[model samples]
Target chain A: MEVMIMKRAIGVLDSGVGGLTVVKELMRQLPKEEIIYIGDTERCPYGPRPHDEIEAYTWELIEFLLSKNVKMIVIACNTATAVVLKEARKRLNIPVIGVIDPGARAAVKGTRNKHIGVIGTKMTIESNSYETALRHVAGEIDVYSLACPPFVPLVEAGELDGERVRAIVAETIRPLQSSEMDTLILGCTHYPLLAPVIQDVVGPDVHLISSGDETALEVAAILDFKELENDLDTVPAHQFYATGDVVIFDRLATEWLGQPVRAEKVEVSGVDA
Target chain B: MEVMIMKRAIGVLDSGVGGLTVVKELMRQLPKEEIIYIGDTERCPYGPRPHDEIEAYTWELIEFLLSKNVKMIVIACNTATAVVLKEARKRLNIPVIGVIDPGARAAVKGTRNKHIGVIGTKMTIESNSYETALRHVAGEIDVYSLACPPFVPLVEAGELDGERVRAIVAETIRPLQSSEMDTLILGCTHYPLLAPVIQDVVGPDVHLISSGDETALEVAAILDFKELENDLDTVPAHQFYATGDVVIFDRLATEWLGQPVRAEKVEVSGVDA
Candidate 1:
């Protein structure tokens, strides 16, 4: 077989620290690949914002990453991915990926009764992104969507596993338990950290799907198929950029990304299409 | 001693059917109080919406009841109360009660240590409404806030006492466990039904505050102060109204509110000053 060569980095962007979760999975699964991550913490929660703004903000981030010569891009924010993925895919020449399809596929495989519950950002739930994806995969499957807008802030605040968080989660996710869903998709990447709590709330019968893990697998598959798998000899270069607090991002990156990561602050001046 | 005039009706309103929990407490505590409840079920969550919108919606519900000649109004939705209580207090002719103060007061009194964990909807937490209320009652207390946006939807979906709801509860509220909070505030009225799950998740050390219970005490206090207390009656009149699914509102009201209440569907016009 001829030797395959890839020169560019893989771009991953999220509304905030949540995308770091997907980066962690990518690091574990695609060790040789150089990764560049941008967390838009400053204008986070693309969830409640207007669709046009979400689309514009997402493209601006993508363009920023593209300027760095990224070979592929990952839209990690559920809200962003829900509304902008199609436009982004068309606008970019390089491979574009989002967390929704992989998560839905995984849920389809994981579910015993074809009943699935999806919880995510307001935009994600409002758009029925996961429901559409799941239905596209298995037309007969039932999809229940609940918008868990507060989870992002709770995680951002660094209260991953606390009583206050638990009470909020228990109260927030209580409605999902009423459904007969055998699987729950952690529609937001930030949600995996909350997997244990979600698992507890959904019960043993319901399987929990991590969008990060599933999306990572999808990345691996795409790279393998395209023959673009990186085989760098030296230490892998991983750069993290945030439009918010670099200090907290550094702490969270170290916690989520496993390796020591120094995240630099990026100032996004204006919205670009 | 002067003879006191009993109030004709006690009005309770929530963004959705979750406020039935407060009505449940009210029914148990004040059996003779005629309850007129309105659940903005069509817009079940006032948490994630804009403050202005929440204020407008609350006033609309309050206005609807005012037209019905309600004596006292209970703002059962944490989000609405957080954003609009002050405005409601100023605008309404009758006594306007919010669940936050009562709930915060209950948390302060119940806690052994001053450390407290508060959980509510996004608006409730983001507004720092509960924290403010708690601090006002007890000064220099360490308060932790987490917004569980999915909670009300979860409870409404019927996952009250189960392993699934329990797991989600544990995960979401995990942060407060380490804070060594002696008391936890269920800042949203809907949160009371998840009390067992919340208690199990938080373990035995933390005492959980039910907004319903606190509001019940407040109702009693207000009634007593206003000299509107009524004698125990064999038959109580409890009327419920919903802007959305009357069937669902009635079902949850019967389950959570303790008494079988026939709720009517009403048009939710804008709230006038």
Candidate 2:
């Protein structure tokens, strides 16, 4: 039997285009690693879906990337990562990393007052996944979690900041402000995109941790530890695939990635598997 | 035969606390009416969820409100309104109203340039419901729909205007600005909260429509037609319920509603039925 070598491509999947946030950070942190991204725009906002459904959808994306023979898998979407990471790691041949643990670790490390705030999709918050992760490391630390449900949609629509976004920021986060937290975890991948707005709302004293950046660092460490770092001579390129409109994926990718992206359309089915 | 008089509250539900936005408008539009508002804080960001799940969840909320004997239902969430309004109307005994059609009607009536821009959740943009509503009323007009996914999270996190939110806004709406659209529709109920940021991003030529406010008008009209409008003689009271933390809800409600709101925690079950 011939052995297959893992390719340099780092596979990333989100319920939709928000995973580009991780891709954005991955590009900055690991410049030599090519990224193969799959955004399931066809059925996104995995936040509210039943656990079984989310698990299935996430696995489908993972299988697609695995079929490409990617070196590793990154569950970029917070909801998917929160709900399915363990199962994914168990099933995948290569290392499967998620955003929650890295983000929780960073928040734990960064907090000075022992008061840390966490924000993400409603389902993520409802699951208390971050609280669990934070408690696992530092049980006595105070973890405040709020679900900023509409945030991903706002980011996707491109209304990042303004009076409307500000008001919503004020409304959504008023809960955290009263708690007097010193550091806040930007738990959702889409949140870093709204860092300025969130920072302003939480004020200067609160430190905002972008899980995207932290997760990228985690990816780097895992790659180095496993001797899986892509060779430097290769020019890293990013390819985007979506089940939705290619024009939308391309526009969003270009806007998010800071470079022109041509997303190819893929016909994917058989997932009632 | 005995005739019984019953007191019924108007039901309003949003993906999250942003429906306080509709509450604000409702307070202004129908000061004497009692509002029974349900915000699905535990499972929000309905914009990105699958159509079936969104419909099921929205119906769940509707069923919950119906159990409360609500005279009318206001779907203050954009995604919920977009994906489930007709079905909701068909299923419920009370009058069901959504934000999009009312907002689209207002945009059609408000625009002088005949070119309108609509922004909301990804589901809202994908549905083209706003465009469909606008075109149905005025066949020759041009409509542009932009999906601003991150806006809600930014606003919920309390960042209205900041460098990060601005950069994201600039990047997302730049293409629309170049296209020369004059009137903009805040298609999402949560969007009006980000109106200032959107105005700054899109510039002054574009008029912003608050779908929340328009929906409030629809509520008022329906109330008047049905003779369900509350009398202004007594002090108006608004009741807020959340499946999540009451303190978080109260804090956000007070901030968004301007007046102090003491939200009460309520058990919500049988939403899917």
Candidate 3:
């Protein structure tokens, strides 16, 4: 039984390289556990898509992970988590965790003045997931949410730290300056890469909460609680699969995770059911 | 199915009233979910007991909660979490969460200089659970642990603030002033009540991580993941049980939770199996 639990890898899914942020955290926290990551880069940027389409794509990704017999599943993309987390949890018996609640909990806990801000894709902000979650944890707190669609693109383009990116971030967050939110939730997994620029724009007094780090912690606790942790002495190799250009995916994965990664392109067509 | 999910209460167990901190957090975060708390006050201060005795006492509490058809369980005491979390998860089918990992994760994330401190009873510090958990999440960091046995007793006595308590706190934490730990884990749930004095002694530069709050977040996340969340609109009355003096338990529970509590006494003699 112990060997079976140790052998089963954790499944992580994301819309694109954005999920790599969560994967990076999981790798750092659970070094002994094997990870199988799948990035739906072909349908990358699930933010702009309709809810039905996003749900379908997320289901396809989940199906692929289920095929690999993962002991647990992590929805690394905020957009996917917003749309499909409830339904997925209902259907699957294994543990399934998303990024929103963890981030919301941290933001609520860190905030002293009962005021918080959230920045994410348009769909995530529109869904009101963070605001709802924050209110669920902390009743009647002021939640100000903004849709920063351009942030993900800049992060994907590797424009993390420069004058132009900083200016864009500053201009985007200018409206929140007067809101006086002491804590801000980085609602998207991709936002952590742009943390320095965001921090500079938001000023030093505001705390930035990362969803990936919080999600990684939740995953670790769940792993221990479920007794699925890998106790083997041998080092485990991580596996990555993408439904888009393999070379680009491999490059981004390596860059974001700070390690050499060989991302393979696989066809996940007809998995939308 | 939804009705059944909504009706099942969350089971929380502790060595004594210290677990009320966790219960307080659960009431704050998951207001709609029903809670069934059992305090093994008859075997209070499990911290000084043998590991086997502690494990047996913890299982008795778990069995009592399981008899209530609880949807989940939270080990609110650090010493109990250190000794029984692994075995309980292996033996039970429902989700089981402990306080240590969540507190460890938050401390690791909150710290900037890779230096952290932990304060708990002798057993918790001796168990090395927090150190192991912190290392599991953030590799190669400096961990300084101190056993603050007197703190819990002071809290149990309701001596949260005043010059006398402050003096005790200052003297107790004087050793860590030079350690320069940016984050400190209130490893014991009872410590949060003394947070003000601890913060004053540790200085404003250090962040205090509460296991109760963090564990509450983990419980909320697990509830959503397991599809066991109570989404009903009606308010749920919380149930409390104790194995010691019912009047004292009720008084402490009412004082700490800032609400009226009806505590019932029950005998758990020969429950150690």
For all candidates in order, state the fraction of native interface contacts they contain: 0.00, 0.00, 0.33
Total clashes in model 1, counting residue pairs 3 or more apart in sequence or in different chains = 33
Tens digit per residue, CA lDDT, model 2, B1-273: 111112578999887898888888787555567899998887766766788888777887888888887888998887887788877766666778888776766565556678888887778899898888676444557887788777778888878787898887788777678666778988777778778888998887788889776677566545543446555445657778887778888888888888998877766543342
Residue B215 alpha-carbon offset, candidate 1, angstroms = 56
Give the chain B TM-score for each candidate: 0.93, 0.92, 0.97
Evaluate candidate 2 and give its CAPRI docking class based on DockQ. incorrect
* Candidate 2 Cα errors over 4 Å, as ranges: A1-7, A270-273, B1-273
Q: For residue A246, give model 3's deviation from the true position in Å.
A: 3.8
Best candidate according to DockQ: 3
Task: Pick out the ten consecutive residues of candidate 1 chain B with the lowest summed lDDT.
Answer: B225-234
Q: Mind giving the per-residue lDDT tens digits that candidate 3 earns over A1-273?
A: 768867999999999889899988887667677899999998787887878899888999999999999999999999899999888888999989999998997787677787999999888999999999887666768998999978988988899998999999998988788897999999999999999889988988999999998898788877876667777656778899999998999998888888899988889664333
Better of 2 and 3 by DockQ: 3
Off by over 4 Å in 3: A66-69, A90-93, A111-114, A132-141, A177-182, A203-205, A267-273, B51-53, B108-114, B132-142, B177-180, B267-273
Question: Candidate 2 on A22-141: residue-level lDDT in tens?
Answer: 898787656667899999887776777788898888888988898888889999988898878877766667888888877776665557677889998888899899998776544567
At residue B147, candidate 1 shows an lDDT of 85
For all candidates, what are the clash counts? 33, 35, 0
**What is the iRMSD in Å for candidate 2?**
23.6
TM-scores for all candidates?
0.49, 0.49, 0.88
lDDT of each: 0.77, 0.78, 0.88
